[model samples]
Target: MVWAGMCAAIDHLRTHKNGKLIIFEKGGGFGGTWRDNVFPGCCCDVYSNLYSFSFEQNPDWTHIYPNQEELLAYLTAVAQKYDLYKYVRFNTAVDEARWNENKKQWDVTVVVNGGKDSEYGSGYTVTSDFLISCVGQLNIPKYPHIAGSDSFEGKIMHSARWDWSYPLDGKNIAVVGTGATAAQIVPEVAKVADHLTVLQRAPAWVIPRHDSIISEWRKSLLRHVQPARQWFRAESMKARESFHEAVTQAESAKAKQMREITLAHMHKQLPDRPDLWKIFTPSYSPGCKRSVLSDDYYPTFLRDNVTLETRTISRITKKGILFQGQESETEFDLIVLATGFETFDYMHPLKVFGRNGRSLTEIWHGLPRAYKGVTIEDVPNFGMLFGPNTNLTHNSLILVIEAQSRYINALVDAVLDVKAHGKHLSLIPKLEVIESYNLDLQKTLKKTSFADPNCNSWWKNSEGIITNNWSGTAVDYQNLVSDVIWEDYEIEETDGSETFVLRRKASTHIGRVNEETHLSTSTLRSAFVKCRSFLNWFCYSWNSQVDTQYEQVLKLSSDSEYNKPSRRLET
Candidate 1:
C-alpha cells in the first residue's frame, strides 16, 4: 500500500477496537497520498496481495500491482465499511498542538476549509485527552531550487500535484529528475507527447517488474478459498523479505547478485544502443539509493522522439531549461518536475510544544529522533505514526504501520485505565532511553548500503545521519516493538499520589513470528496455517489461532532500579 493511506486504516481500527478516535483530515476525502498523487502511471511497487491489511484481503485486484485509483477506491471502501466518516472532520488542518499540564489534554489549533467565509468554516481550538499525528512524510512536495524558475512562461507542474486540465497529447514536454516518480511518468508521457526530453542528474538502477494480469478464475478461487489468499500473501511477503540483505550489506553476495540482475535487465532492454547504456547505468551500488522497478522505463528511450540529457540545469528561461555550459536554452510547451517530496520534514509547518513549553522543532534541531519511531522523550500523551527511522527500502510499510498502531493502542489503554479511577496521567520515556537506542542504531546503519558515501539520498539528514530508515529488517523492527515496557516510562498521576501502576498483559494483541524462522520454514508453516484456516471456515469458526500468536516477555522494576537504561539491539 502507499505509506500515507495506512493511517486511515489505523484510524478505523482504533475507533472500533480501542478509543473514541477523531480524525482531522486536511483533504475532503479519505485516501491520503493516494488521493493527492494522481500523476500518469502512478502505482505501487509492492504486489497487490501484500499491500493491504492482513484482515482485509482484496480479491478483485486486476493486476499484480494496483494503480492509484484502485488503491484509493480500496481505502474509500474501508472507510465506508467501518463508518469512519462520522468521526472524521474533513477539510480540517492542524496548525499547532500544545500540551496543557493541569488538564492533561492537548489544545489543538485547526483551520477549517482554509479559514474561508463559509458557514462554520474558520480557525478554532479543540481539546482532546490524547493526540496522535498521522501526517506522513510524503505529503509535502519538494521543488527544485533552480535559478529563474519563475521566468518559465509555459505550463509547469509538479508530479505530486499534477494538473489534469492541461493537455499532454501532441505537445513538446520536458521531465526533470529520474527518481521513482519520473520512472513511471516518462513512459506514459512519451507515448503521446510529440517530443520528450528527460533531464537527469544521475541514473538509477532498474529491474524488471514482472507484472501480469490476474485472471478471473484466479480471483474467484482466492475469494472462495481461504487458504489460497493466505498462501499468496505469504509467498509474496517472503520474496520481498529476501531483499533485506541485498539493500543492507554493500559487500554481501546478495548485493552482488542484485547488481548483476539489474545490469542484465538493462542490457536486454537497450541492447542495440551501447552509448545509451553507459548513460543509463549508475556508478554507485544497486541499493545505495532507491531502485526503480520497470519493464518500460528503459525502452522509452529507444523512441525516435525522445532524448536523454544529463547536463546540469543552470536556470529556467521563458522558453525552456538552460544547461550550465550552454548559451541557448531548449524550448518546450510543458515542463513536468518529477521531483520527489520533502521526506525529512516531520510534523513540519505545524508547531508543537511539549512540557515546560519546549518546541518540538527546536528539540529535534533538524535531526528528528524518537524511541522505536513512536513517541518522543519529552512529548507526553502524544503519539506519532510513521515517525523517525521507520521507513523501509525492501518491504511494504503496512507491516510497520500495523506494529506501530498496536503499540499506540497499548499506550492509549494505559492512559484510559488511569482515567477510569477519576485520575489524570502522563507518561514519558527517560531521555537516555532514546539516546542510547539511536547510538546503537546508527552504529549498525553505517555498515549498510543506505549509508554508502558514493551517493546521496533522502534517507539521511544534512549531517549524513540516516534519519529515515530502520537499522534492521522489517521483522527485526516488529520484534523490537512487540511489547511495551511500562517500567521504562516516568508515569505520573494526579492527587499528588504515586500508587498507580499498570499491570502487564500476558501477551500483546498483534500476530507474532519467530525471530529465528527461516524462509523455508516460514513457507511450510504458512501452508499448514492456511489449511487450518480453511478448515475452520467450513466449521463456522473464524479463529486466527494458527496465524496470530503474541509474545509476552517483560520484567517489572522500580524507578530507581531502571536508572541506567541499556537494551541490546537484536539482529
Candidate 2:
C-alpha cells in the first residue's frame, strides 16, 4: 500500500526475482551521502522516526535528529541485514551505459579502483536487461568560482569531503557559505577555531529545532511496543505534511505563520544582538531558498571569536580570501568551503545513450527532466531513483524513493508479463504523455515559493527553472505514483507479432497528476489525508463482497486464455 512508505521495495524485488544483480558503488561502502558528508554537526533536518525505512524502525536512536555517524551506522546495519553487500562492488564506478537496440539490453562500462590484489584502474563491460541509476544529485561538491583559489597555501576542505586528520583546536578558519551545510559547520567550528570568519552570500530563513536525546525508558517502550513506533512514525509524517502548503504556497496563511515563527526563533536565540539580526534576516520568502532548522547556528555568531562577512569576495590569495573592496586579504590557517553541491547535475560523468544512440546529456541540455521523475520517453527498461522533481522541501525523501521503487516495479512487472506470453516488449513512456505531464508540472510550479525570483537556490536550475523539488506534498506524490497507467506508455514488441495485446489491470490511482494549486483544496485535502487509512480500512471491511463480484465480472470479460485457472490465481 502507498501508506507503507520506505518498506524495502527494492529489496523485495531482489528477493522475489531470480536474476543476476550487481551494484557498482563509487564509495567504499553502502551509505551514499551519509558515508561521504562527514562534516562537523552534519545531522538530518527530518525527525529520526520518519527518516528511516518503515519496515525496519530503529528504536535505538540516541537523538531525535540523527547525526551523520548515526545515520551511516543505521544504513550499514540495514544493508547487512538485507545482505546487500554481497551484490555491491565497492570502489567501482559506471563510466558509460548504452542501449543496444538489437539485443534490447544496456551495455554498461565500469571502472574498478585498485585493491590489495588488483591494479589501479581496471575496467570492464557488462550487459543487463535493465539499468537503474541511484547516483543522486547531491554527490558532487561545488566549489565557488573565486579567482586564484589554487594559489591559496592554507589547507582547504569541502564539507562533502571532510578532512578528519587535520586539527582545528586553535586554527583561524574561514567558512564560505551560510546555507544548511554552513549553518551546521559554523557552530561546531566556532567551538574550537581561534578566529572564525563566515562569508555569507545570502541569508536563509532560520527556524528553531527542539532536539533532545531519547531516554532509555522511551527506547524500551519503542522496542517493546510495535504500535507505539508506528504511531510516532505517523505523527511525524502528519506534522511534516501539515507544513507542505507553507513551502509550496508562499502567500498561504501557513507560510505567513511560518515566517513569524522563524523571526521569533532568531530573536529568541540572539536577543541582545539586534545588529546581527539585520545580517541574518532573509530578504526573500521563507521557502525561496531552503529554510534552515537549528538552535545553535544563530547563537554561534554571538561568540567573541566569530565574525560575519557579507561583502563580495574578489579573489583567493596565497594566504587567504580577498574581499571586493577591502584593503587587505583576510589571513586564515585553514579554509573550509561549505559551498553546497551541484544539485542540478544528476548521473553526471556517466554517459548514457538511449534509442538511436541519443545522448542523455544532449537531451537534457543542462536541464534534466524525467517522465514522473523516474523514466524518460526514449529510455526503455531504465529508471532512476530520486531524480528530477522528486526532492521534498517539507518531508522526508525516503517516502518519495519508496514510491518510485514501487512504480519501477510495476513497469518491470508489465515487461515480465509480456515475456511470459512468449514475446519481447520494450516499455517506454509516450512522448505526448511526457509533454502533458511536464507542462502541467511547470505550470503548477510557477505559483509555488520555489519560483519566488527574489533568490536563487539549489531547488532550481541556472535558468531559474524549479527542477529539483516536487510540486506537491509527499502524500500527493505517493498517490501520483501509486499505480502505473499502461495507456501512458508505448509498448513496442520486438518479436514478430501481427497485433499488440492489452492487459487489463485495475488501477487504484489514475489521473492523479496535473493538479492545480494545492492551496485551493487545502482544507478538504488535509481532512482526507488525516483519515485516509481509517477510511480505507472501513470501506474495505464493508465492500469486500462487492469488490469480489466486480473482479469476477472483469475476469468474465477478459480473453479466455487469460481467464484460465492458473492465470486467475496469479491475478
Best by lDDT: 1
Candidate 2, residues 1-571, lDDT tens digits: the string is 1112113334444645654677787777777788889999999998887788766789899987899899889988887776666677778889999999998778999988758413754888998777778888788899888899899998999999999999998999999989889989999999999999999989999876767776665676578756556655654555576677777788876677778878888899889888988888888877888888888998898899999999989999999888989899989999899988888878787889998898888778787888999898788888888888989998888878777877776666656666667766677878889888988999999999999988999889767899998998776787778777778877687775524443555342422212122221234334434554643342343244224322322222233222234422101
> Highest TM-score: which candidate?
1
The TM-score values for the models, in the order shown, are 0.88, 0.86
Q: Backbone clashes in each candidate structure, one number apiece?
A: 0, 0
User: Candidate 2: which stretches are off by over 4 Å?
Assistant: 1-9, 12-17, 420-422, 496-500, 503-571
For model 1, residues 1-571, the per-residue Cα lDDT tens digits are 2343345345446554755767878888888889999999999888887787765779899987889999999988877876677778888888999999888878999987843423675778988777778898987889889898899999999999999999999999999989899999999999999999999889998867877676666677678877656756764665576677777788876677777777888889998778988998888876778989888999999999999999998899998988889989989999998988898878977889988779898778888999888889888887787889999888778878777777777777777778888988887877888898888898988888888888889899767899999877677777778888776677888776665663445344444432222334345544545655444342221122222110000001111111222322233
- Deviation of model 1 at 147, angstroms: 0.6
Model 1: runs farther than 4 Å from truth? Answer: 1-18, 114-118, 502-571
